[model samples]
Target chain A: MHELSIAIQIVEIVEEEAAKVEAESITRLELDIGLLSGVERDALEFAMEEAIRGSLLEKTQIVYNFIKAVMVCEECCNEFNTDDYFNSCPYCNSLKTIFIKGKELNIKSIEILKQ
Target chain B: MCGTCGCGEDEHITYRNPNNPDSHLHEHSHFHGDKEHSHAHHHEHDHSHPHSHDHSHDYLLKPGGGALNSQTIQLQRKILSKNDLLAERNRGHFEALNIVAFNLVSSPGSGKTAVLERTILEKGSDFNCYVIEGDQQTMNDAERIKSAGAPVIQINTGNGCHLDALMVNKAMKDLKLPENSTLFIENVGNLVCPALFDLGETKRVVIISVTEGEDKPAKYPTMFETAQLCLINKTDLLPYLDFDLEKFRQIATQVNHHIEFIEISAKTGEGFNQWYEWIVKHRLSETD
Candidate 1:
């Protein structure tokens, strides 16, 4: 699955932070996963946990914060969030809207053991 | 019973002896009276006070430490910026070579490789073409292209869902392509992840075949909308199949009005000339 590749990135991000902070163990990892990032949260967690073993982040906990998908109306400059990817703005029926958010995938923070 | 310093952890339990220090119930860091321990915070602190250690707490806050905060922010920026640099480099490479690269996307059986093979055999000797094939495992498509007598480099994505700019950069090193070449990258067979990654292509071509049904453009509009051209392949079998050419184009146009449409039969050589003329026009337009 693509989650495995993203999981590898998660490990790289956490390990980089751990080395910078001189931390021995990573306790928790926070991520901001976009709604439209095409990543399943549970799959990412499972992939991260499995990939972290035998690495520097053996005891890490991965927590995901999902970002809502927001689109901006081209006609009225209105922004709205919708579960449907192709739905027009609820406020206006403008087809000229562009997706503003919900494409982000980043490691927000990493909690390393404060040793 | 008295509350000490308004800290919530040392709540007065009626059954416990207040004078005995053992009555101090171990509470979570949120109620640990440390204002710095807001939510999921971790740090080192010299807590030499006479108390038991609780590493089981969700996180420990390091009091009087500001350096760690900046280091965390710096690392986040570095990771993202590194990838951004590689993507920008890829864009520059495509531009300097004067190559109008279009990333081709479709499902596995949607005839992407077939369309490419047809395009190469028809216009390969004319356009100075090259292909970068993406797949989970195997150099089969690249080998097919090499047999067709065109320069091609196969990039085994190796479990990668899509082709990123960094991968393209590595594959470019081995390609013996001339400057001003027409590069076509056939992305891994998927409709979702490939839409998200921009591989520094001049255009994105979304190929849909007659057998896949006409409702595909409406179902996967993102791939259709992002692409500059949408090619509906397999027109020769339209008589045998229920595919309507006008209906498919109309649905696609509703989603992406500006998308250019091309109807070609890659197998029967019916619309290959029109496809080649379009390619030649695009390539020749680059200099003008």
Candidate 2:
């Protein structure tokens, strides 16, 4: 799955950051993965386990925070949570809506042991 | 790091010509600046040190404390920002060279290769056309484009589902495309992953064949939403199939109101004039 590639990217980024800080090893990693980010959480976790071997994050504890998709209706400006893209506004029944959240894929923080 | 894929820059991407079995492999590694400091800002640190006087116990404990003194560093950065920055660099390069790059995306069997073949055949003589074909394996598509008379490079992505910005940047270096030229990047045949990657193209074109069903736009809204042009290919078979063109258009519009559509038949050369004209218009505007 594409999650493998994403996991590899995460590992690469953390390794680079860890090296910059002169970290002996990474102890913890926090990630923000949104529902609309197009990433499967389980697959990413599994991939990370495989990708982190023999790397800076070999023994790191990974934490993922799932963000629910929130939509803002363009017509009535009503905010609601939704998982589907074709959903309409509940208040005005308008099809025109934009996602205000739940498209984020970010590295929130990391705990590293200084060398 | 290799410039071909953003996931791991060190990963090697093989580029080869289909016609020549011994075609020299073009290998390039794009190393972004290594001097950049870590964006990690230390927010909290465990300063408690469990100092042990026993010589044997001290060897087991870390220098700062019995356990490693770890600090939580806040980054709060987008995971794909590296790819985005590389994409912006590609966009700037294209602009400086007066090149118009188009990223063509679609599902497998969507006639992307056919449409490209037809386009090159019709416009190759008038324009300096170069193509970058992305596939999991094989140089078949590159061969087709080469036969069509356009200089082509094949990117074997291995297990990659999409071509990221870095790959295009690497291909651009190997191609060394001249000014006032047109570069078409045929992305890997997948509607899901490619939607998330930006290859720094002048415009993104998503092609869907009538045989793929009318609900494709609704099912894969992200691809349609990101694309500027939606080409409904294989219109020649429209009369023979149960495909509803109007319904397809309506659904696609509902998903992406700003996307423009063109009904085309790459096999019969129908509706290609408008497609060519669209390219010409965008190319001229890009230069201005």
Candidate 3:
């Protein structure tokens, strides 16, 4: 699954950041994954567990902040939550809706303990 | 780490010849630092500098009262930023060479290689064409493209589902493509993961054969939505299959209103001219 690749990338990013701060160990990591980001949460967690073995984040507690997909209708200005891209606006039945805030896949923060 | 997977850092991508069982190995290490960190920061205050202390003023400070200060670093960085930056570098390279690169994506048996073969056969004399073929572990596509009379390179991605921008950048260096040429990057035959990666192609063409169901556009909207053109291949077999052309078009258009579609049969050359014309026109427009 692509989740393994993504998980590895997350670990790499965390390791790089932790090295910059000279952290003894990472205590926690928070990720912001959106509903429309095309990532499965459980799969990512499993992949991360596999990816972090013997790595700097081996003991880190991972936290996920899932963002819900919200679409804004261009025709009727209606805002709705949806996971599908082909969804139409509920109020106006228009397919001209755009995603306002659902595609985010980011590492929001990381807690590191200094030696 | 393997460029595709982060298992280990020393893994090198090996390019092997399809025809020869034991051809000379061409090993290329994944280029690190190709992607620039857009969010690099410099702290003004130095944490390593110890604060001034007075031993006589022990009354002012209590021993063992202060706790270790753990820091929470705010990154707010996009997960795919590295790939995006590398893709941008590839775009810059393409622009500098005036090359129009097309990313051909499709299912395993969707005739992407056939389309590229036919395109090269028909237009090879008029233009310089280069191909970069991607597959999990095969040089068959590269062999086919080479036989079609064009320079071709094969990238065996071992375990990667899709070709990232870094792979393309490496392939470009090996290709030595000429200026004002068309580079066709035949991505690994999968619609899902490739849609998430940007290969710095000027245009993305997704091919779907008539043998497949009309619900493919609805099922994999991300690939259809990301593509600029949808080449509906195997129109010659439409009479025998139960594929609904109208329904497919409707769903595809609903998913991506800006996408252009062309029905063609690379075998019989039916509606193939239109496909070539579309490419030439877009290439001209991009250059202009």
Candidate 4:
């Protein structure tokens, strides 16, 4: 699905960054995919396996950090982890909640090898 | 890489005008991070030109790893930044051209095209509208919009689930949209993927029919959250279906406080007046 596109984007961004540094190859790629980012991890991983082939990331170890969605309840002033945005607060059963995390889709870092 | 760029032919996104049916294939690989990605070609025209080129610098083609060094580069960059940057460029272009662009997003069969068709037909002699129809693979919507008396282009994203800003930019180029006009970009019929992609539209209108139920807002909160206007379509069918309109509004408002509601029926021409008013309000951008 869109994970394929996201994987392609990841590869493109990492490759571009590596190119600027004149890196020969990327040894590792660290990705931060929040649970609420709407991207499935398995889908992205599968896509990455195909996306990295014949590229600098061919031999690279890909690491995925699936961040959990953190929500802050406006009623109880308590913070909690949720799998989705619609989850009511566990502590207060309040629907008036603000999302603090788990929507992040970012490239945390990359281990590049230079020649 | 299609012999020159590192991209394959499958990565090409086609923009086709329904009236003409001639597609313009644009490569997405080159449009990723840089405007141009160039690497020295080492393969000969004849032989087994091994596709050994890794996505790295030119030196990787050579042998020695004796001078190879590895380092952990810390860059917490958003992966979609490339798309976002292009989206901003699109916004700038629309601003310069004085074109008010609206990104229409919804699920399949939610009457996005129907809304456009009715809007274009009913809003006659008022504003010039250009349309960009995005689907996985179909010219049906484009053809429908063209028949609705508006210049339309169809973007058939082969395997792409959602339309990105790059695709919209390319389509915009092909459309050659007139100044002081309206551009309706009907995004691929998906609530999940399209939520993350910013197409730089003046206003994002998310459409949902009564049959979709109230849970749609809660299920796809991101889509509802990001959108500024939520068009509740198929009000005519509400008499038959036990669709709770108040609960839907409640859930939608909870997800997006700033979102405005417009109950429209693209079929019976009911509530087209409010839709047109909303369009004019956004086209003028509330400055007036």
Candidate 5:
């Protein structure tokens, strides 16, 4: 659903970067996807391919790296990695938790072939 | 090959490396070493290169895609930053116009529409009311507001789970909104994806009705934490439902202490006056 819109944003960013670096073709796009980012990787990839057609980023490979969700328990102060979107702390069973990492949707890097 | 440094400048650039003859990696490396020194590398080849191949220049783009002057542009563009930039643009636009737009988010059947309906009925005449309604289908909510005599536009997401700023921008175009209008955007009935997107709204109003369960604030705390105001709607249904209004307030406050909570029922016209008063106060403060 939001993947198509997200894909459009991806295309816009890549196109802007291509223009900035004065590059004619984009070879690779690297993305860091967080576990709790709620973005479907396969769906996003498929959407990106369809969205990038007839654009400057045609025939580009999208390299996505998924990061596991991590959080710190407010009660026990224990930090743990979890794939669970919602779960109590394993140590204290307390719902008071602060998210440390994951939930990140960023373009980590891009490889453009210079003309 | 040059024997001293193993740099291939010799007469025979063989596909086989003189060292490690039995290793497969050596054979593969030798193949690439010859490939890099192919006729394309030489300026005198008279096919592609007009200038002599500079030893200093790094020829990263392999000449593969023919005749479009195909230069591959390598970049590290943050996908989220693009939206953030547009979001900032929208924030600036709102600030310049002195308009306060709020994105209302909640679960389905959370009394968001009722809150708006009651709000419009009470204070629609005082301020220019405009709404951007997001739903999977039907302009029913928009129709309701239009009959109430407020400027309303319904955005049928078709299957979209959230409303992005770009869609808000398009919806605003048709609104013909006033210079300093108070725009209320009722996001699609979703607690998750809608929390991630920013619609250039000054406030993010999260509605939590009593029937959905008290643990809603604890379970889906992101929208609660992110919102500026948390309206606990449908208070009239509190007695029949096993919903603890006090417990809900306690958990919601723990998640967001600074957020203002208004418990009201848009239906039956109970506790709506307080919401109306708050809106007027906010609008006055903003305009002042």
Candidate 6:
């Protein structure tokens, strides 16, 4: 799955941070994965488990904060939640709309203990 | 997810040329997110710096029990920023070389390779063409494109589902990408994962054959939404199947307001002129 690659990326980023700060072990890993970010949570968590072996994040607590998919209707400025695309404005019945905030995958923060 | 050995860990991604056996194999490191391309690659950050940290990212340090200090680094970095940055570099590279490239996306058996074969064969005389084929395993598509009389490289992604910008950048260097030519990157067959990655192509072309459902656009909306063109392959089979062209166009347009469609059959010479016209027009518009 693509999640393994994403997990590998997470591990790489954390490893760089850990190395820069001389962290013995990363205690926690938090990620902001929006619904529209096109990543599955359980799949990512499972991949993270495999990707962290023998790395600085070997014992890190992985926390995922899934953001809901929300779109703003350009016609009426109404915000609506939908899992799929092809959404029409519920309030104005207009097809003009775009995603506001559900398409980001970011590493929020990391906790590490300096040796 | 490692397809080759099934060890659930990624192996090195390889690029091979079926036509040139002497220079067929080129292997690269699997550290996708790391800036290092080689095992001996050094980090720019000094390992033994005296100052705490001087990075652009925010730092929050609190005293731990005794001498050991535990700190929280508030780094709001995008996961694919490395890939995105590399993709932008690739776009600049293409601009510098005056090359027009397209990242073709589609499901398996959607005739992506077939479309590539035909496009190269038809347009080879007009302008130079090179290809990079991506799959979990095998060099089948690359060989086929080679048969079409073009320099081609096959990127075996191991268990990876899609081709990242790093893979393409490496492949371009190996391809000896010429000036004022065309490059087509045939991504892996899966429509879901490939939608998230950008290869820094001039445009993305998503293919859907008439044999598949018209609801594919509605089903995989992100792929359609990101693509600039949708090539409906296997139009010759439309007579037998229940696929509705009008409905498919409507649904596809619903997801992507600007996605243009061209119907064609790689097997037969149907709607090829328009496809060629698209290649020429887009190349002029993008490069010139």
Instruction: Identify the candidate with maximal DockQ.
Output: 4
Q: Candidate 2, residues B1-288: lDDT per residue as tens digits? A: 223222433334677666564563755453433322111221243442222223232433576555655689998878777878889999999999999999999999999999999999989967689999999788899989999999888987765678888878877887889999999999999998888788899999999999989999998888987899999999999889999999998888777777899999999999999999999999999889
lDDT of 1 by residue, B104-186 (tens): 99988778888888888877867778888877656678777777766776655444456666666655655645688888889
- Superior by TM-score: candidate 1 or candidate 2: 2
| DockQ of each model vs. true complex | 0.10, 0.37, 0.33, 0.40, 0.16, 0.38
Which digits, one per residue and each the tens of the lDDT, describe model 5 over residues B133-179? 87766667777777676787776654456666666775666566777
Looking at candidate 2, what is the lDDT of residue A72? Answer: 91
The TM-score, computed over Cα atoms with residue i paired to residue i, of candidate 5 is 0.69
lDDT of 3 at B174: 74
A9-86 in candidate 2: lDDT tens per residue?
688888888888988777778889988787766666665665676677776777888899999988899999998677
lDDT of 6 by residue, B233-256 (tens): 999998899999999999998887
- Candidate 4's TM-score reads 0.83
- Pairs of colliding residues, candidate 3: B1-B8, B1-B9
Instruction: Write down the TM-score of every candidate.
Output: 0.73, 0.85, 0.86, 0.83, 0.69, 0.86
Which one wins by DockQ: 1 or 2? Answer: 2
Q: What CAPRI grade goes to candidate 4?
A: acceptable
What are the clash counts of all predictions, listed in order? Answer: 0, 3, 2, 5, 10, 0
Residue-level lDDT of model 4, residues B103-177, one tens digit each, is: 999999999999999888977447789999998787899989888999988987765667778788988988998
Residue B79, model 4, lDDT: 86
Q: How are the candidates ranked when ordered by TM-score, highest leading?
A: 3, 6, 2, 4, 1, 5
In candidate 5, stretches whose alpha carbon ends up further than 4 angstroms from where it belongs are A22-24, A40-61, A67-100, B1-77, B250-257
